[model samples]
Target chain A: MALAADPMAPIAARVARVRRELKDVWTIDIEVGSGGFPFAPGQFNMLYSFGVGEAAISISGDPARPNTLVHTVRAVGKVSGALTRLKPGEFVGLRGPFGAGWPIDVAVGSDVVLVAGGLGLAPLRPALYRLLATRENYGRIVLLCGARSPRDILFRIELERWRRRLDIDIEVTVDHAAPDWRGNVGVVTTLIGRAAFDRHHTVAMVCGPEIMMRFAASELVNAGVSDEAIYLSMERNMKCAIGHCGHCQFGGDFICKDGPVLTYRHLRDRLARSEI
Target chain B: MDMVQSDERSILTRAGLDALIGTLAARGYRVVGPKLRDQAIIYDDIAGVGDLPAGWTDEQDGGHYRLEQRDDNALFGYAVGPHSWKKYLHPPRLQLWSAKREETGFSISHEPETIPPFAFIGVRACEIQAIAIQDRVFLEGPHVDPHYQVRRAGAFIVAVNCGKAGGTCFCVSMGTGPCAKSGFDIALTELLPGTSEPIYVAEAGSEKGAEILSSLPGRAAQPAEIEAAEAVVTHTAAAMGRSLETAGIRDLLMSNLNHPRWDDVAERCLACANCTMVCPTCFCTSVEDASDLSGEEASRSRRWDSCFTMDFSFIHGGSVRASTKSRYRQWMTHKLATWIDQFDTSGCVGCGRCITWCPVGIDLTEEARAIRDAPAQEAKP
Candidate 1:
């Protein structure tokens, strides 16, 4: 079989625009020539700069947004810094919205719980927006968000609007609070213990730091949610977003190809390994 | 037909052979055959028949090789070399794509080179198998590498039947060599001077070979010459010094993943990647990017990569195979064991190139034997 063509070739993308979401994070809206980049909410693109190399950035825009694709990037590495510094007219490379994403269809008709920590919220926000857009399909929509500090919370205005809606519950927490802050004080997992959830009917989706996800999943499990009902988005050093390169293998699974999103039941034993 | 007539074979005198070589050179084909280099047999372009390493033979063992001169003048001499046909066909590094930026947009280009035609003068039977193995990898895979296909299609192979086998050769076990039975345009067996008749038993295995031979100054071999070729192949088969127990090898290695033998070998193994470099079938690679000092534009290039490298399994903040033992185990197991699952054939060709090229002289055959011989130890309850 002929090898697939190189997917990372930079497209002629004008940084359609940029919007500062939080203190450190900025969203760059790009006009991609390849129309309708069909990406699930949790999939990511390997964003590339002409000279600065590339980094994996999650797709943060609405899946319905066809002409413009949005990526919320924090100034972490050389490529991210270059991406954050780009003006509206500059260009960047976009590889894919690769990897398996949240099973939105499976979560339909079920009460939903979105547990997001720090930058993890960026991927979940799209799913939240989609669910809220068609609120009649879901029973109850709850979003539990946590950040390092009060100012670090992303989509603060959106969180406020969601909190005002009668059909949804928005609970925000921070590891540390500033002088004038009034909100949940502990980790996001702490708020989960207080929320009244029908664990049997709820589908929990958790994405965060590894330690945070472990604790959040444990809390969900303790509240009677089966491992099969809990989904987590795994992060790995994925060189090729395809399965050919063995870099992103976890046990027998290629995380880049098989999943960046997998139910806890599928990975419980494999993730228990010391090295994984 | 005459069964064993001495005069039936048309003898190409030494001078006639030289003249034939000159005629070939006058034509466009670059004739590459075997030559003695660096105390080992290596393939090189020959100017004439004199450039051939006549009367030279090599002794090969695990991690050891030495060429010894012979008293008789024979054109096709010595066993396989470190370099396979892959060097010319699937080069170590080649450009796949190039991009140039313009005001409107970026213009990307894929410039695949047209492969040049060349005659391989003395390809061995096992090397032929190696070429076939590479064909499956480069051509039959999901993504056909155009560069390899171009070169492979253009190569004209002249296979030399092995009259003498190397000590380390286990092609017999691998079902590969000791005779160039097929897969060549023309096959040759050189008869020694003291033999009943001095001539080459040449047979055209392809139409191209028949055309080339018809044009050259040589005639049909006699029944006696054909008998002599058979005798030489039988002798070479009987002379095989090493044998591998290939029976149930894939299963044996797979079931013993946690075997202690891996750690024993890892103690001496440097993970230097020499084995992979010399291996004919190993095809793992990585991509690299380079840019001008101004950091305006960059080009990405793919280079040969080895599983031995730490970064090969890097994930997030750490490496999956952080220990040398794990990395070595992964490589050996992948080659000898799991490769059957991936490629539907045993990865090791019993060519002994990895054994000879290894800096620490760690023999894979020996390691396999050790693992096989070791009594199964139960893990702690």
Candidate 2:
């Protein structure tokens, strides 16, 4: 077969490791060649699994290490199922580090609030790393995490280690948890009101299902946070991650390029509709 | 004459049309023109004037299109069909890339296309605008579609100003048709009045058009013939069978998204996506990958997609616009409302293929008017 006349061509990369994070969810560590592919924090890569298919998975690794890219994908469909089953040393096709990254510049020097639900944490993980690495540059950083149950929690060991730090305030929550679960029993939106952060100086970064973001954003708004300061990560079925496929158009904006991360103020009208 | 200035005009007899085709073929160009097929005039490969639907026009309305025989021998008398010029420029199915199984894993190969410049004959003014609109969508972005770029850059446009309007046509309201304003190499107006035989008052829109015109059998058009051609276009403009009220239309659609008018349309709409398939400017697409029986080699391809599909708005959980009402609203709002916000121009070119091809005969202009003219009613879920 002939290669596509497009920038959508993927570069070969080797899967270094695969860790089962939760039920039907995994985090794969991949490494490109010598120079190590450099990319921004919130950008994602199009991972192709041979004959199965391709999908957009966010880069979840530390930005400091550019060569080793990490992506966490849930086994929701065929392509992701194929990806989660790959063993170490297996090669995969990768196309990017495409799309806009989390706005670290605007979040800098301000109190940061990170809210993630279920697998949504994967896209925001790199931003959290940058916040912790430059801890002194930004104000107090709070991480509020949520999942379906205790077993669904991702990066369990890392969340524990982060809890030990005095600077990073972490709150964990789950829905329909077992009776013995010690974390908060309600949704993540409940965690926002009591969470400690200066409302005026805080920059809230949120990523989750569309409904969850809606409730969480409203809670933030009601809590005296301005819409401009809250950023939400938007996802669409992106065929060409560079924006030409037109699959990811959220109204006039191409969610792939104009943003995977758009300010609440910008997307407020679009987000309210049942369909846009 | 002096290299045929841009404003230079000529009279192209029936025989001269064939000579133009010969000129394009001699220059190694594939001439794609409107030909009668499947009872509709579709753009296809044509050898000469005989292939054109001479003396044939079309009657078009919502969910209606049928060929009609005309008294005159004028070519380029029909409205658009289910297919747009996009099928040629931006193809329906395009291979994005391929991954060959390697000893280690896969060796990815990039597919670059070198498309031969094609001569597009019998193109309408609205289609010229449609192609220009798609150019912005594919080319103006940070990522320019290489395939679209290759084909579009290589294309030679030969526009035909409408001498008759279809029942569904509202290109006049959209300010895109009835006459070719720009974005053409050559433009022709077929003037078949009561007195004289059929003649095309042709004008050179670009240097290439002038070069082609110089080779064809034509002479400087008499001043009276030019007036007759202008009269033909003016008559078509006045004879528009459909009209859309565009004053603040974008805001009207955006604000009334939840109006009961949407529910009314949804009741009739089947979500079959025929309108989008026929539209000139609906550019949404989806991609898929296929492998051989060996499973060692694979190729990915992108194909035309419509918002009416359940998967078009799909995420990991489910489709966002699952309901018929939501899907219909997305299509109309995107076409008339959000497209202006995205591309600084309306997505519609006023070529009413959607109305003509719609299975339910859902007229977008009528729907918009129903929403705009009616007093605001409580939105139904």
Candidate 3:
């Protein structure tokens, strides 16, 4: 396999450490160079291993922490499984911080509504942290998270901390729950009916499974949020972080470069495609 | 400017041309020209002018190609080959990204060296158009491919006017050939013996071409030589055995997406990717990764990928185009219909390289004709 000497290729990163977040899900924290990989919230990196293949994974670390890059991956395929088994001091290839990220500047003054499902919360975590760090810049911050079951819920400790904060409204829901569960037990979409929001002045950033985002976006729209004000993180098979490889193309736009974060209006038609 | 006679435009005699090549080699320019490679003529680096396929000519038709030796010993005895100008400019596979593990962490590797200047010897008019089309894709786009730009910027084209058109060639219909056009820096028309005039008409289309010509031993072409060049072009146009009716071809293919002809062709199509491999303008690729046995380090690379492959359109669980019919449809639709929407021009240059190189000999023009002639089917009420 010949490598095209790309100018935008990211430096090789090593898994300095690994922490298991859940069963089969591990968080690999890589220690890059001094000025760690600087990436905006919602941008993804293409991680590759020799013999195995490459995958587009979101950078889950806060942009403020540049030296330590973190990625929470579920072991599904050869590359992801190989990545999970990577020990401390193991080397892996990385290329990116590619694609348009969340519009932090635009969301500064508006009330932020973060809607995430399951592992989708990984990419949005950075944005949530960024907003919390600059708490005085924005209005009330609302985080509505959903998971398949009580056991699948991520960032449980952080969710509890956000709930204790005066300026944040955090809601956690699960599709199915045990008899011992005392918290909200319903689909994430059902909880949307009870939440109070200033739809006109709010920016809703949703991520997760495509079906979840679509249903969430529809719920947000019905609640009076405009399509332009709703942002969604799209998932696609991206081979090249650059626009040359046609794998990630949704019609004319290369999702790898043009987006992973796109306005609901921009990707409405493309998202309607059966397989996109 | 007064056009000189063809005999007067001899910057280098047949022997002098060989000497000039030696001079070029001494200067460090890798001189590449047409040579017999594999079973067909291909461009490769040559030590001298004698390396050129002297008396070999090719016969091409829809799904057919053969090479035969001509009695006359002409330097450029053959028509175009499967290889295009892209082999030098936009290579089939390039390393766009590389990364290596470091003590502190991992460091990504980018191309450190600039592309070396090269001299192309036997480019044709249709291929010039193909190069221009690629320029739009690589250069004019929002994100420029620095690798392609560097190589293309340093390339020196020596275009040849077609004196004989192949059976599958429809450059006349595509308005791309039979004669050297504007994109080339320098153009040449080979007028061999036995004709009313025997000469090689040469002209500079760019300042660099003018400089190269001034350095060489050529003079201004005569009026008769210019007329002879025109006659050769006209003769080649007349010799074209294949012609595509480009009149509303875009719309015809776009509207007839469900035509039964595509299924018929799909049955014969091998999906071997030979057509795309030989085509001058099909530019699709896929990336792969490689690691040492220990999995301590890894390298990611890209390779030429064809749309015909089952893996090309694979999404989550299965491929979007699972059947050979759908894959062929997508490839053809993207080439003839959707390409106009993406790029401003049609993807096919009517060079017929795809038709001749296809293992099953699936002819695009024949498929188009079949769809065009098919009767309209009524929808069920």
TM-scores of all candidate predictions against the true structure: 0.76, 0.96, 0.82
Chain A fold similarity by TM-score, each prediction? 0.94, 0.97, 0.94
Which prediction has the highest TM-score against the true structure?
Answer: 2
Who wins the lDDT comparison? 2
* Per-residue alpha-carbon lDDT of candidate 2 for residues B1-381, written as tens digits (9 for 90 to 100): 233334579988888888888889888888999999999899899999999998898999999999999887878778888878999987898887777898777876665555567999988999999999999989887777877777788688889999889899999999999899988888998878675668888888898888888777777888998899889889999998899999988777777877898899999999999988888888888889889899988998889999899998888778878899998898898888888988889999899999999987999999998998883643321
TM-score for chain B considered on its own, for each of the candidates: 0.88, 0.95, 0.91
lDDT of 1 by residue, A22-85 (tens): 7778999998755667788888888877656667788888887756888999886566888898
Please tell me which model should have the higher DockQ, number 1 or number 2. 2
What tens-digit string does per-residue lDDT give for candidate 2 at A183-266?
798899999999989999989999988889888888999888999999899988777788777778887788888889888988
Name the lDDT of candidate 2.
0.86
Off by over 4 Å in 1: A1-9, A19-26, A40-44, A55-60, A72-76, A96-276, B1-33, B44-52, B71-76, B110-114, B117-144, B158-168, B172-257, B295-297, B374-381
Clash count per candidate: 9, 7, 24
DockQ-best of 1 and 3: 3
Candidate 1 on B1-381: residue-level lDDT in tens? 212222233435455456545655666666777777787778788777777787788777766778888767777657776777667766777665555666755566666454446678788888888788777766664445565676777677878888778777777888888787778876777788584333677667777766565555665676777788889988887877677777877777755666888779889988898888787777666655556786555676556777788888764457777877877877776767666655577777767787777778888878888878973543211
Clash pairs, candidate 1, are A1-B141, A1-B142, A1-B143, A1-B144, A2-B142, A2-B143, A2-B144, A3-B143, B9-B222
